[model samples]
Target: MAWYGQIEQLQTIFDELERLLPSGAQLTSFIATTVHFMDCLINNQRGNLFTNVYHNSTVRPFLLPYIPSYARLSHRKWFRYAFIHAFHYYCSFEDFEDERIYIEAIFLANGYSLDFVKYHWRQFLKRFNFSLIELTDLN
Candidate 1:
């Protein structure tokens, strides 16, 4: 499926999950199911590689500009964590090696160092694996 299609599929699942949230289901269960749903949407039986790329580089640029500067500044730890998660999600979904390199350049031009990007990249991978395992029971 195309990217927008995948996103729409996730949105539909989110809408369903939101409806389920008030049912007193365990928060961990809800989040795990939600993440698993997103994983399935992106992976679509193809496997992990595409999902990784889509989650990381392709999605970062759009998301970065929208994050409130105050939030990014004052909540640096949380922001970094969230950013890495989103980036990892994008990277997980798409193959974009050249785009990854390009995004690194853009990040540098925008005042982030390659080291910073790499740090998040590694962090995301770790979290991604853990989350995937937690969500799908497929570690």
Candidate 2:
């Protein structure tokens, strides 16, 4: 069938690429409905593509400490950017919620107050003029 031919072609390409790898390096790949790459988990579901943020299991969760005395303008800016990236990267409300909680945990671990994180989270939702429920319904 056409599907079998496509699989053969793909294997050929993978073999060629593997041959080009430098010494002591190995080709790591997955052939499945889902795969993780960088900060995103890519999925192919019934021919539909979806994505969610990926967290590596081997890496420790840590961030630069956010000391009250050392709070800089850049710190606040980075927080905003993190929220924006989560909002844009997650394809579903549930995924976004998970990322939001993970972000809060990282910030809290770094010494940010719960109130501070919640306030900015609310502002982010307000800027988009939508609640989590609305996002779920839309998706």
Candidate 3:
């Protein structure tokens, strides 16, 4: 989908989340952070902004490459699903890590379900870790 369409879809999801979640400082903070994350992800300059930071040896190999054709076809849905999972993982784990507060705050504000988030988190960890292990063995 086009960037505008993606933004619209995210806005709709946020609206639904707002309706479902209770009002409070926690909710407000989560919503703000979620919106900011979405904006950053969708922004054209995001590659230049965070790609290097995020592509460290610890994380880079697990990330899907930014190949437009593959992204447009084979991996678009996977990318979306992985991102949702990543966001949730970042949120729940960060509660313990403290240093991850910025990313965690965004996920909480977005109002993704804890159950769904947890499920995704496990899947992401399993898949990425498996891939990392396989790559290491090959090397």
Candidate 4:
């Protein structure tokens, strides 16, 4: 009964969130979606449930609509430092068996968009068996 109550609460929240911000919405809707995603994160912490909420997402996609037309990404070594910490944090939690994480890390390091990586996910998957040095050699 208690779990069902939590599910109901989440459903209510998502209902209001999606009603206001359907996919490919305007800039304001994009911003609101980001807020909703954050709220979703705050509400979930068990790390074991497959809620299909914001946990299954990356922040860049929501914020991309808000980015200006003149926006550009300049890859720098400093950014790698932060990513190193983030990558290790995820690795520490997982068994380090998922190759997709490493490929995603490389894409992020090179300033690639999530959509780009996802589109080429199959090619990335083929490289899963590559050695550590081989992984680093990817473009």
Candidate 5:
């Protein structure tokens, strides 16, 4: 395909991702979509990758300018943590809170419900295996 075709396809993928906000969002889909969006942002030219695709490269700069600045430019590590942890390939909590904050910010930025934290809080915890369920015995 041509360069313009690739750009158009990327834009379409990005737009469809926007369609999956708080209502129709699934954790797996969201992660995949974000990865695709990141690919477009970092692809300066087709297959020209001396740059850091992970966005965690101190050796190479992150290229996703479209990712909100408030999301913190140094978000790659926490994202990597979440990605790896989800697969149970690795598990650690060095800066897990920051990762949650980053994902939350992205959800809100994309017009997800403002009460996302409240509504999905349990699901989020369960997904990450950090349940916070609390109940009192009232027998």
Candidate 6:
């Protein structure tokens, strides 16, 4: 098929897909250097692609509350899991630190003490053999 015919075919497909969606919602597409999908921000700089975690502004931050009614072990496990998630998703140290602060705030608002968060954060760094300086320098 000719290149122009292929373009028309692609447009027709996109129109059909948009019609399948509910009313008032449109299927928009892009051909760009950057794209945000699900929870990831992806970028193509030249030929190298980079990805980092993406948070939508409309969404609120939430985590399991560290209240007395819940088991302490469960609270601790979830607390540590937040750190693990931050480490896994953030490609840059600056982004990770921002996420770290956000994580602490969410827990604090949900009743976890600052001391509790600080101690676990320190332990997490230690277990990963990461000093504050090293973490910053490496990323």
Q: After superposition, how far is residue 55 of candidate 3 from its true place, in Å?
A: 15
Q: Which candidate would rank higher by lDDT, 1 or 5?
A: 1
Task: List ranges where model 2 is wrong by over 4 Å.
Answer: 1-5, 10-30, 62-71, 131-133
Candidate 6, TM-score vs. the true structure? Answer: 0.60
- State how far residue 85 of model 2 sits from its true place (Å): 2.3
Score every model by TM-score: 0.32, 0.64, 0.25, 0.23, 0.30, 0.60
Q: Candidate 6 clashing pairs?
A: none
The top-ranked prediction according to TM-score is 2
TM-score of 4: 0.23
Winner on TM-score (2 vs 4): 2
Model 1, which residues run further than 4 Å from truth?
A: 1-94, 130-139
Model 2 earns a TM-score of 0.64
Model 3, CA-based lDDT: 0.41
- Give Cα distance to truth, residue 17, candidate 4, Å: 0.3
Q: Candidate 5 residues 16-113, lDDT tens each?
A: 76677576664332322223334222223443422222334353332233455555525444444443443231122323344445555655664556
Clash pairs, candidate 3, are 30-109, 31-109
| Steric clash count of candidate 6 | 0
The lowest-lDDT stretch of 10 consecutive residues in candidate 4 is 26-35
* Candidate closer to the true structure by TM-score (higher is better), 1 or 4: 1
Worst 10 residues of 5 by lDDT: 130-139
Where does candidate 3 stray beyond 4 Å?
A: 1-101, 130-139
For all candidates in order, the CA lDDT equals: 0.48, 0.75, 0.41, 0.41, 0.42, 0.76
Model 4 alpha-carbon miss at residue 42, Å: 16
Cα RMSD (Å) between model 3 and the true structure?
18.2
